[model samples]
Target: MIDMTTGNPGKLITRFALPLLLGNILQQTYNIVDSIVVGNFIGSEALAAVGNSGIIIFLLISMFAGIGMGAVILVSQFFGAKQEEKLRTAVDTIYIGMSVAALIITLCGIGAAEPFLRLMHTPEGATMEMSVTYVRTIFLGTAMSFGYNINASILQGIGDSKSPLLFLSIATVLNIVLDLLFVTVFDMGVFGVALATIIAQGTSFIFGAVYINRKIKIFRLFSHRMRFDSRILLQSFQIGLPAGIQNLLFCVGTIVLQRLVNSYGPAFMAGYSATNKIDMFVFMPILSFANAITTYVGQNVGAKNLDRVKEGVRSALIISVSTAIIMSILVTIFGRYLLMAFTQDAEVIKTGEEFIKRLMPGYFLLAIIFTLNSTVRGAGETFMPMLASFVSLLVARVPLAYLFNYIGGRYNIFWCYGAGWFAGSLIIVSYYLSGRWKNKAFRFVEEAEKPKR
Candidate 1:
């Protein structure tokens, strides 16, 4: 049996995080490949066009993924508690994913794709039409992204992280192959790049849906209704709503920051984008452990094994701290080479180097922050991470960026983002230490489910 409900904490965390790390690495292979193709083939401007859309990109994907997190939290708990019926009931959660918000965001995102690029002051020489192609293409594929996230989340919720990773690996390879073929053979540029990603993700969506249908033995899901169930919908929304909102708010804040990066022109845009890539490298392993903790914490909490949750958190802390230190050193030392991987432009390289040095120190704090938040959330403590991000992102980061950009030069923009990460980390640290989330329970989901009269 694939038991996520009980296990040794240290062994559990390692087992879970390793596959998660591999999954993340595979996922990133798409981006790294895209960057090299876009940078070398179309030029830095094309890279910036893609880079400039980071907010819209993150907003769309993260929003649904956030909802996925909700399912993970609830289903993990149910599975841990050995409540098979509740687990089956939760299958309806997919409806929360197919929302009006998805439509609204996609339309607005596609519509604003070009204008937003212009707002960033995209250099005419580099970004002409490329931004539009990149943003519009990504927005068009939101439905595929939605499906993939839902299917994958369902698998992850039951502690089958490797299952999602398996299909995702296939998709990642297809994406790269298509990216090279389109960009190289067809001479398609950004549009080719964008199309490749959508097709790849769409392919993954198909594979995941088919795989789950054949493998996961949920009755209502596989037999009863090919339609959305109110009970399942309610549970899905109950879990996904807050996470969705949090990611939306966070993405909005990133848009504010993206606008600031825009003002620096394409060279700076490329530099800062490279820095963002570096940040992801830092985020992956910590994220790996954090993701594990959610399952570890969620299942254990459901099984009423609070002791295991505590122990897993400790193991996560040691792993996270060590990884953070190592990544910071690697980033600090190889920052230039990494930047060079994206663009050979001397000006962009210099700017990327400068931006990275400023952000390196904060990686350690972020390592703790991400792990703690994920652990808490996995333990069913959503509010703290939500509250922490809300305050730090909207209240601190946005306003601070405005202030710094107005008074200081471009360097202040980088600092503004760093400061928000720093502040959010502190808030998360305080919240984790408080032990309040430990007392809270995920009652929203259970109450949301009702029988048809």
Candidate 2:
């Protein structure tokens, strides 16, 4: 619908990527703002309660959010093909699947909250209690969060990335104000952090849902079409499930790393947690650009403009790699100041600064893997991503982390993140270059000249 196949890609990419980058950054403001309000208001240990659960939070919501990837793929293809009926089908179908997923995850959240906190070996005292309270509150809001992701993905697929950016900006700013008042004014502690995130996420979902209902002329909620279509569900799952599982595996691996971090005590835990927020700021833009390439590639490929897809990818690579190099330099230089922003602990700041120095070199490789995997997803190939993650997380990272703790020495643990990132990048890029996700990967390509329906 946006005619991505014929646009000047440099102009198109900058226009699309800039708003997306802003959206992603503002979306992260929920966390950065939470850390600032809490650490400054409460103290370092309480900050650790809110901070340390980062991976666990991803684990709870990621599966359903992955359906959003499927939504983007499905809707973008239909949009490029100008199939209005199918685009509407994608929106309705995604809500059904994601709602079911949200319910299941919520149940898991209710049951698993205490056990997970215990598993983290949280210290006996107020801090452990705070961790449990924070995690449960965040988990209860999974539906609203995933609902927003699914709807936003569908809209973005149809070329409306800016709308999500606009609404998220309002939500995140509200979240910041709430975090300050709840933690500083009312003394809510870690629960305030969770409450703020949920409120922000819920507000964003409501705004997006309402805006699309009245404004997006391409989509209309049809009551008669409320029932599930087995065919559509199956196709969506084919694209989304693997991506979801990749995220699941990645989260699992991080939880393992969190355990490793915990073994070093709360100071290390707080430091690692605080530094990671800084890391994500750099990661988000590259991620947003990767998403842009996915949409650009998806639209052109859907229209059967293979050359445009290829050229778009080429331009994207140059831009992405260049941006990653810039982040590497900035992170290396600003690493200490970032940690000091959250905690004034001399030891924690030192640990975090050292970690950042070790970590920046891997950002380029991480960017490469991100761009390539997103490209595969755009082309509707999710299996390689799933397999790549399985190997990277389960087979490589977790085991390597164990070995690092056991033999590579205690301080070498953070290096596991870098090593795992590099290995995953190699695995992802190798898979892409191996011609597996290429349309030619299917032997049926010669027999059937068009994408299989």
Cα deviation at 381, candidate 1, in Å, is: 3.2
The weakest ten consecutive residues by lDDT in model 1 span 442-451
Cα error of candidate 1 at position 303, Å: 1.2
lDDT of each: 0.77, 0.77
**Model 1 Cα lDDT, one tens digit per residue, 292-368:** 88888888877777777788889999988899889988998999998998989998898889888877877777777
- Which parts of model 2 are misplaced by more than 4 Å? 221-227, 440-453
lDDT of 2: 0.77
TM-score of each: 0.91, 0.93
- Which candidate has the highest TM-score of all? 2
lDDT of 2 by residue, 208-280 (tens): 8788878888775435656555566776677788888888988887787787777777778788888889989
Question: Cα lDDT for residue 100, model 2?
Answer: 83
